[model samples]
Target: MNKDSTQTALLWIVAAGFFMQALDTTIVNTALPSIAHSLGVRPLVMQWAIVAYTLTMATLTPASGWLADRFGTRRVYFTAILIFVLGSVCCASSHTLGQLVIARVLQGIGGSMLLPIGRLAVLRSVSGEQYVSALAMISVAGQVGPIVGPTLGGWFVEAISWHWIFLINVPIGVVGLFAVHRYLPRATSTAAPRFDLTGCALLSLCMIAFSLAVDAPSQSHRAAWSTGLFALGLVSALAYVPYARSRRNPLFKLSLFREPNFSVGLIGNLVCRIGSSAVPFLVPLLLQLQLGYAPLQSGLMMLPAALSGTLAKRWIAPLIRRFGYDTFLLVNTLIVGGSIVAFALITPSTPAIVAIVVLIVFGAANSMQFAAMNSVTLKGLSHEDAGGGNSLFSMVQMLAMGLGVSISGTLVKLFSDQWGSAIFGFRMSFVCVGGITLVAALIFRQIKETPPAIASPAKPAVAGGR
Candidate 1:
């Protein structure tokens, strides 16, 4: 085959990896209740399934680049597919929540490697001019995943069984394994940086401690356990700063935070995502558990948001050019947060039209917010620091997502018993999460000077995994 044809084939192979990873993120959300029932666990307590996958991904993603550099990209990418497929098989075979969470961690490990390695393969194979279009093509798979994942997962559960939701990855992975081996070029970085084992350990432990604390079972000793975990997590995370400062080649440079916009944007992304990330997880539950919607029906209801988010991409550059990042983010953050809060108004008697409108509005604002915030965050980085900055930004994005679900789940669990109903619990959960997001808008105000916005549409930073 010609070079162009070879590159085209390589792009598709990588896209398959992107699609599988993105699909798994949303697919399981709609199936949470069904999976919980099958495992004989309470639906409310099943947030661990989502948390485990996302947290593992966040914890492991920083290592992907080094692995691809040390081992060849083709070999690493192939192994990722293999491991992901094995994880899926394990998930389908799981009989208990513990088994499922363990399977998800395995899946997350594979997922953490897939996208970065695939992207590396593309960069190594393609020329500079071709890079943008190549990445755009791969990103389409990411976009389509969220669009169809929930609905597809719902259909699998309702028509067949929840296990099919996981088993579906088997065929895709099989094909990916074959295509990657054939089409991807082999390459390795000549000067791969030393692995930051200590930094990785500290950050991973901190994330686990915090997530476990937040998701701790609501019991007589809950407060004590949560407090200890929170303190440990905070201290461990803070310790990374000093460690990074002392090391000549740390995992991430502490100096990256000196840029005002970068600092503020990072904080804003984490805080805002913590509030908004709960929407995808919450919407399906509200529709199925509170109202009378079936799993498939609830999944389909997500279409409005997904569709509008796609369409909203075109509007981002124009808006950023006009209002600039500072003004745009300030106003848009409220819209996103308020839209989340609006879900509290949803009830059985609420008109479907009203809910659809709300979803569309929220989708558009959130999409714009993602594009703006990501651009601002990375836009300030010097070329030397861009890769590490981008990697850390993506890590925080996933971490916040897992944290969001834990926060939302714990709130719902707490209020359900307090208010004596799941509906009220959900309502209060939305309000609290929304309030957290609204407060996050204040952090954005710290961006005193606006940075130049990029002309390209930014990919939606994955929240909680998706």
Candidate 2:
């Protein structure tokens, strides 16, 4: 193939991988209730199915770049798709909650590598001038996935069996595997540095421990175990500080935190996302269980948010240039938080138009928040620090997502148990998570205002993992 043809083929290959990953992220949300019923478990308890996938992705994502460097991208990317397909098969075959969670973990292992490695491949293949444009094309695939995922999942569940959700990936992935083998350049592997095994383990353990600590009260009602896990997580996090200082090449340099915006952005992303991340998980459940909507109807309701979010992306760069990151993030953070809190008012008696307006507002604000937050976080990094900094940022993003679901599920379980009302539980969960999001506005306050620079084409926001 000609050089142009090769690049074109590569773009499609990567975009397909991204589409699969992004599609899986949101598609499961609308299907959770059905999956729970099929597996003989309560819908609220199904957070593990989601949490397991996200947490596994979080645990392994830091290693993706290294694995790609040590092994070739073509090899790694192909294997990722294979594992993802196998995992999907397992998921479709699962007959119990535990089985499904395990399958999700397997799926996440593949998902963890897809975007990062695909991005890396494009970076290496394309020239600097083409890099941004290439990424923009790939990102469109990510966007399309969420827009269609919930509705597609709903349709599959309603018209066919829920197993079709997983089965749908089979043909797409099989085609992807062939395209990868035929078209992807076999980039030569580099002499990679020794990975920070200790640092990676400590960080992974911290994420898992904290997530389990949050989830334990809901799962086992074991306060002592939860407390112990929380303590362990805290200790592990602290331990990484000294360990990184001692290592020649830590998983992430502690100095990355020295950048003011990066630090604030990281912290803000973690705290703010904890609330907003729960919405996709909770909203479908709310629509179906509390409002008595069918799965297809509930999925259709998400169209407003998904469409508004995509449309809102074009407004982010101009808004940031006008308002500056500090102002934009501070005000938008509150808007996002307030929108989340507003979800509490969406009872059956609420007009459908009212719900749609609220979703549009939240979707737009949340989309802007992600673009500003991700750009500001990475913008300040030195060229040397950019790769590691981005990897760490991605890790925090996934961890926060897992934490969000864990925390939200625990809240719902606690409130419902105490109030003996599921709808009331959903209401209070929205309020509590929304309050958690509002706290990030205070974190954004720490951002130092800078003069606006000329606007550039926006890089794709991190996948919302909806």
Candidate 3:
């Protein structure tokens, strides 16, 4: 294959990895009830399956880049697919919630690596000119998974069984394993840096503690455990600063923060995502629980946002080129946050057209924000810092989603109990989450007028037997 064709083929393979990971993320959400019924557990109690997957992913994300460097990207990426497929089979064969949760943890181990490593590969594979569009294209494919996942999961449960939700992964994963080996170039370091075991443990503890703390409110009514865990997470995070400073080689170099755009962009990404991420979890519940829509219908309602997001990728490059990242992100952040607030107005009496428009606007703005933030964050890093920086960014992204869900769920519960109305609880949750998103604009404002220049090219790769 020619260079252009080789690049295209590589991207599609990476997208397949993304699709498998993204599909699993949302697909299981819709099937939870059916799976619970089969396993003889309350649907509410099955949340562990989701939590275990996300928490495990967040905990293990810091290690992906190191593993890819120590091994080779092709070998690691292919192995990730194999592990994810095996976990899916385990999930399908499970007869208890405990077993499913364990299987989900196994899946998370692989799922965590898919996007970050695939992205690192793309960053290494493409030129500066192709970078934005390449990432956007990959984002488009990843977006497609969420678009189809819920609707497909619901249909499978109704027409077949919840087991099909996982079984569907087997065929796609089988294809991916071969495609990865065929198309992806080898990426490995001759002298990989020594693993930062101490820093890794500390960071992992911090993520786990924080995630479990926030998630506790949703799973149980106890405040003491939640508060304690939150404190422990905070301390663990603070502890990392000192360890990183004293250590010769830290998991993530503190000097990464010296890059202005990266620091501001990273903070903006985390805070903004925490607020916006809740929409996926909240919107479907609002549709089914309050609006009395069926699971399939609720899933279908997500289409407008997903489709708009897919189309919105094309708009990002021009906007950033014209307005610049600092200005574009600052203005667009509000739009994203405001759109979240707009959901509060969505009721059964609300016009379908109005609700769809809200979703589309939110989706478009959110997609742009993500593409821009990711570029700005990674663009500033030195080539040597790339692996650690990418891992940290990925960790924050996963943890933010978990935080978003936990915060939204807690708020809804609080307001629902206070008002004795479920709809009112949802409205309040939207407002609160949106407000938190809006605050992220202040963080984005700290970005400088110009983006930092890329300092070096990523390591070389071979495609089409180059």
Tens-place lDDT digits, model 3, residues 54-169: 77888887787778888878888888999999999999999999999899999999988887678777877888888767766776567678879988987888788889999999
Question: Best lDDT goes to which candidate?
Answer: 2
In model 1, which residue pairs have backbone atoms overlapping below 3 Å?
Answer: none
lDDT of 2 by residue, 1-466 (tens): 9999999999999999999999998899889899999999999899999999999999898898899999989999999999999999999999999999999999999999999899888888998899888988988899899889999989999999889888888999999999999999987789999998999999999999999989865455598899999999999999999999998899999999999988998999999999988999999999988998888888888888989999998888788778888888889999999999999999899999999999999988988788788887877778788878878888899998988888888898899988899999999999999999999999998988755542233333355322
Q: What lDDT is obtained when candidate 1 is compared to the true structure?
A: 0.87
Off by over 4 Å in 3: 1-12, 36-47, 117-140, 179-191, 218-221, 451-466
lDDT of 3: 0.80
The TM-score between candidate 1 and the true structure equals 0.97
Which 10-residue window of candidate 1 scores lowest in summed lDDT? 457-466
lDDT for model 2, please: 0.88
Put down candidate 1 lDDT per residue, 10-37, tens digits, no spaces. 9999999999999998899899989988
The TM-score values for the models, in the order shown, are 0.97, 0.97, 0.86
